[model samples]
Target: MIRAYHQPSAVEEALALVARGAVPVAGATGLYTGRSRREAELVDLTGLGLDTIGIHDDRIEIGATVSLQQLAMASSLPGMEGARLRRCCRHVASRPLRNMITAAGNVAHSVYWADLPVALLALDASLEVRRVGASPALVPIADATHGGKHAWDGGLITRIVVPRRAGTLSFGYERFTRTATDYSLSTACVTLRVDGSSARDVRFVVGAVSARPTRLVPVEAALEGSALSDDAISRALAALDRELPIAPNYRAPAEYRRELTQVLARRALETARTWAARENP
Candidate 1:
């Protein structure tokens, strides 16, 4: 059934409408494909000026309505971080879909196959959320996306803030799919800093095999202080099964997905190690 459509020009007006049960629409990609046939009022957020990408000295703030294509082409993001994010963004569907999918919408309505959130989790990004009758809050990507808790909770995500790291920082991303635009079978993203011969601040995230992107804490611990040697990588791989418990999916069996995750994760880590050596040396 068709219903009324309202375009709010301000964040506060949008939040108020959302609180009153008006379905918020950004890119409308998910809304169109969604199976919800019930009648609903739509509140469009495109006019709220939430599409700017600001690059600062210590952090990069991405507005919620920014398109994936815009993010991929942003010239301000430099070094390995920029390359990593661009690669992840390019892997999502196709150029047309990327033009229509908003960053906040992808993260907020995250599916198992979502790719950007994996990279964001590895980067330790945070979301600036605005709610009715409350001050805006910054929510960490891990807390906002994982643990079955909705970060917005009827509120709106205004911006996504990613902290910039200084010196010898490297990142790696990997995703598997039958076709270029097909849903991912497995995905992995890694980021770390190299201090001389040892690795520091290691963050390894796995996606497409679970409900949400998950950080492999034990695996990170195994590689954190090591030199990313063969032995260290082996130990980290051994911790993978325990840290990442894959759930069954119709696209693939649980065992298959687990094995695929191991392969993708290994490739991502190896890529990161190579980049670290190249950048640090």
Candidate 2:
């Protein structure tokens, strides 16, 4: 199908075009692989200068068009924050695809196999979205993904904001795949701070096995006030059966995915615990 393509240099112009039914695209990677073949007008968003990454005392701001590869190689990010982002981004597709995949596009597409959202969920990230006639809103990752496409119906995500925690934090991420570039079968990400000998501010997230990345509140609760001992980790793993939701996939059976998720989650937690102990000692 043939159609008009427009590259707007201003956010207002892009928003106006989107309001008029044009589909906005940064990398356009999802559009190529997307199932829908309907003819459509395309609005290019890369011209709007949404490609910079800024580090601030309170938060890190990533523009919508920032590539995963750019994030993986960013030198401004420090400590555990840099480590977590690099680890997750490096696991994303191959190098070439990572260069063409934008963070906003990845989150807005909201595919089950997406890895960035799982790490974002664990990091308590938020999105800044803009619409034609309304003030820009900062939406939490959890709420932004809660209603799927409906939450982003009329707005374009302009940037992502990750708040910096005050104290020392440890992070762990794990994913399982059939090949180096294959879509993930299951993924787990955890971030926690150790206070004395107990865990605090624990955020445990699991992805790919469900329709959307989900925070394991029950499992987080199990670890929140307890030492990350073997017994406590076992109890958290037991909570997975009740909290983790499985979606059917042709790549793997449901039972196999469930067990894989449990194992990956346990490993990620252990990794975080190890880091916490080393850093807190």
Candidate 3:
């Protein structure tokens, strides 16, 4: 059955309610639709003044409560940092769903098919979370999703921080799915920082094909200080597992998903390479 729904005016009150077993839900788009049976108090975070966006010192701070629609419509990022995020947000789902999906909710729930995690990983984003009776803490997206997801239990993500790079940032993203709103079969997010034709930093995140997102560490190392030419891209692709252990689903076979990952990842890196070349030219 249904019960209490509280919307606290302050963070402390919200924390207290959660400490006492209240479940936090903002943009309840994913929660209400899912076939969940257990019920409890719902702490609506529509208030508490957490839905603000701020920019400073080459970084953009996105409130956890900020809706995907809000982010999709953002005018600009100071240095165009994490530019790929806007596209990711815009395509998260249909218009109605995007309007009700909160950034915090999306990451907290982290439906395996979610795109935000890969985007955050590519941008090296960090999260700010508040725990029961404890001061707020900053955690890297990688760390927060590591080991066990229990890191956010009894806590709530307050904001996400995207650190801007000083040099030109080249970003590319691609998602493979049968339909526009259908969950992706595989997704790739890549960001490259190039200085005078040499790659300074590269982050390539592959998701939606496994239980957890995985970074191509060997590929990233190979991309360093080199222009991602056709040969270079080929070499990186060769390093990937011939057959990734992607869990099979009704939407696609595991082997097919692995092949798609290799293709999309190549395209993403190649596009990023072209963007980097533009910086030096």
Candidate 4:
């Protein structure tokens, strides 16, 4: 038996309600784990006025309740480095599921294969978090969503803000999956910003290969100011060996995942470079 479901239109009211032990549920799609016996207050965030998808200066502010569908529809959001993330969100589960899956909901769950958080980290995004009787503050994407390193206590993710990419940018996503809708065995998000013939900025992120998203910083550092070469890509891929250690899982063996991560990361980077060349030319 579920208790009362409160719908507050403002953040203060919502915080007050949540401080009283209400479980904030933006979308309940991922929380059906046969635990109905342990029912608690489900605070529906649908009416919290947190469903905006618009560009706020150089950053794109995505309200916590913004659905995956809305994300897909607004693929051209300012500062959205790559549409590959939106593409991943669009095919997540099914139409019905995407209709209910919220960006904040998915991130809060911190599922292994959730793609948005990984992509957001690559874009250098920040999350606006608010808690009961505390001042709202922005936390870097890396620190804010670090798996098991830190936890958000009594804090609600209000919005996600991503820095706008300058110059020509390209993005690609690689997911190892049995089908389009299934959770990824491993996924890669790659983005490249170009200035003339040189790579201005490069980002590579792999998901499901570790407990949290691993940003290939060594690879990014190595590729900056270099042309998109097969050798450069190989070096970037090699950097993964030291960055991530995949654990054996039901979906794939540790070795298999490690190799797939390298392959996918390379392919994603190549694809991004190709698109960047075309866009900048």
Residue 248 CA displacement from its true place in model 1, Å:
1.2
1-281: candidate 4 lDDT, tens digit per residue: 67777878888888887777777878788777422225567677889889987675577888999998888777566543536557667767777888899988877777677878888887887888898788888888788744354344466898887888766777778888778678888888877778887776678788887766778788787778878788777777777777765766888788888888888887887887788778877
For all predicted structures, in order, the TM-scores are 0.95, 0.96, 0.94, 0.91
Q: How far is 116's C-alpha from truth in model 4 (Å)?
A: 0.7
Can you write out model 3's per-residue Cα lDDT over 123-218, one digit (the tens) per residue?
A: 888899898779889888888875565467777888899887787879778898888888889998778887877776788788898766777777
Q: Write the per-residue lDDT of candidate 1 for residues 1-281, one digit (tens) a residue.
A: 64878899999999998898777778888875542235377778899999998888888888999999998887678765777778889778989999989999888777877788988999989999999989999999888853566788688999999898887888778899999889899998889989998999999999888888888899999999899998998899899977786877899898888889889888988998898888777
Error of 1 at 106 (Å): 0.3
- Compared with the true structure, the alpha-carbon lDDT of candidate 2 equals 0.87
Tell me the spans in candidate 1 whose CA falls farther than 4 Å from its real position. 32-39, 145-147
Candidate 2 has a TM-score of 0.96
Is candidate 1 or 3 superior in lDDT? 1
Best by lDDT: 2
Candidate topping TM-score: 2
RMSD of 2: 1.4
Off by over 4 Å in 3: 32-37, 242-245
Q: How many backbone clashes does candidate 4 have?
A: 0
lDDT of 2 by residue, 128-219 (tens): 98999899899998888544464556669999998888787898799999999999999989898778888899999999997888898999
Best to worst by lDDT, what's the order? 2, 1, 3, 4
